[model samples]
Target: MAPLSDPAPRLARAAEAPALAALVERAYAPWVAVIGRRPAPMQDDYTARISAGQTWVVAVDGALAGAAVIEERPDCLWLDNVAVDPAHHGGGLGRALLRFVGREALRRGLPQVGLITNEKMARNIALYQRLGFEEVERREEHGFRRVEFRIAAAHLAG
Candidate 1:
């Protein structure tokens, strides 16, 4: 793809619930198997409720290749989830979507953007680090160790 750092207008709205769920499934399935349970909404029942912040997507040739869920709760800007189509993994879509989050956070003057990922997923953690997120907290839940990472607004802008 050409430079994905540039925002593509209204591209995410085209990704309706079903397609976004499918992409989420492909992205989360391996984690489900490794962690012994689905992380967020499972297939057939997944709803894309990314209203509080924004949903950003990456497309190639008009196809839904990846997506991200950014929610701004009363507390902080939350990067709830990010997933690229399994078929399009490692193609810069994930990084592009993450850049979108940083830009959005900087745009809104939010203090930071945070998210949780399974601790066992080392590669995901590394990716988050490369994207400017720092591990801020950790907790064990339902037999899974979850690590929370936050990227400061200054970091996003820098």
Candidate 2:
């Protein structure tokens, strides 16, 4: 396949739920062993998220390659999940989706964007930190040790 050229994410359509769900599974499958369970996104109801207009998808060479699930909270845009197909890993799709979150937060007039990840996923925690997200806290939630991160939307201004 040709190299991806800064793939842009778009709102996920309800019909794409199954494909998006599969993509998320493929993306997060590796973490199951590390976290000792399926990460939350692996079991998410993409159809419901799509119906809520909270799902965004990225395609590479015309195939679904990544997705982001976000919720507009009162104070910030909560980035519930971001997943890139393992086949598409390290191709900047993850960064693109993350940058989209900042713009999305700004568009909605939110001051910040926040996300949480399993504390055991050290790689992900470092990646988020490298991408300008600041760790806000660490706590056990829903049977998992979670680390929360946030970045001011203004910090991502381009």
Estimated TM-score for each candidate: 0.81, 0.94
Clashes of 1: 0
Superposition TM-score, candidate 2 onto the true structure: 0.94
lDDT of 1 by residue, 17-132 (tens): 67777778878888887767887534333343634325667766776677777777665678777788888876666776776776677777777878998887888999888867
Q: By TM-score, how accurate is candidate 1?
A: 0.81
**Model 1, 156: alpha-carbon shift in Å?**
3.6
lDDT of 1 at 23: 77
Give one digit per residue, the lDDT tens place, for model 2 in 1-158.
Answer: 43443666789998899999999989999999999999999999999999999999887766799898999999999999998899988777788778788888999999999999999999999988877889999999999999999999867533
Task: Please report how far candidate 1 places residue 131 from its true position, in Å.
Answer: 3.5
The number of the candidate with the highest lDDT is 2
Clashing pairs in 2: none
Task: For model 2, state the Cα shift of residue 143 in Å.
Answer: 0.3
lDDT of each: 0.71, 0.88
Clashing pairs in 1: none
> Worst ten-residue run, lDDT, model 2?
1-10
